[model samples]
Target: MSLSSFKREFARHYNDTPANYIKTKRLEKAAELLLISDERIKDIAFNCGYNDLANFTKSFRERYSCTPSDFRER
Candidate 1:
């Protein structure tokens, strides 16, 4: 299938754009790691496929309304 066709079908079934769905899943994994692991936030972000610490912080905050460290502390 074409990229656009796949994106449309993916969004139709998932109710999220492909990029957002992937990003959300990544953030969810990060949140789980924050709660369950002793790994540092930057490492968790990297493990979750984030290349930039600042971008990870911004995305995590947007999804969870808190930084990764704050989420872990909560």
Candidate 2:
């Protein structure tokens, strides 16, 4: 299938775009790690498939309405 066609079908079936689904899953894992592990935020971000710490922080904040550190504290 064409790229656009595949994207549309994937979204229809999953209720989210492919990229967004992956991103949300990554952030969810990061949140779980933050609460359960003693790892640094950077390490958690990396383990969750984010190579850039700032980008990870921004995405996490957007999803949880708080930074990773703040999320851990609360």
Candidate 3:
């Protein structure tokens, strides 16, 4: 399926907008990087399409309720 059609179908089934779906994927990738890589926070932020560490941190905290450092510690 085309990306637009897939997005529509996904939203119809899961009630998630394309932006949210993309964000969810990015967050999942971020979690993997946190667990598996020794990359810096700035590198992770840029890789995940976040230009600013503060913005990344804010979104990460909002979704997970913990700082990235804290999340990594656990």
Which runs in model 1 stand beyond 4 Å of their true positions? none
lDDT of 2 by residue, 2-66 (tens): 99999999999999999999999999999999999999999999999999999999999999999
For candidate 1, write residues 1-74 as lDDT tens digits: 99999999999999999999999999999999999999999999999999999999999999899988889999
Looking at model 3, report the run of 10 residues with the lowest lDDT sum. 23-32
Summarize candidate 3's per-residue lDDT along 1-74 as a digit string, tens digits: 89999889989988998899888888778878988888887799799999889988998998889988888888
Q: How many angstroms is residue 19 displaced in model 1 relative to the true structure, after the best TM-score fit?
A: 0.3
lDDT measured at residue 64 in model 1 versus the true structure, 0 to 100: 90
Q: Candidate 2, 59: how far from true, in Å? A: 0.5
The local distance difference test score of model 3 is: 0.87
Q: Give the TM-score of candidate 2.
A: 0.93
Q: Quantify all predictions' global Cα lDDT against the true fold.
A: 0.95, 0.96, 0.87
Cα lDDT for residue 25, candidate 1: 95
**Every candidate's CA RMSD:** 0.5, 0.9, 2.7
How does candidate 3 fare on TM-score? 0.82
Give the top-scoring candidate (lDDT): 2
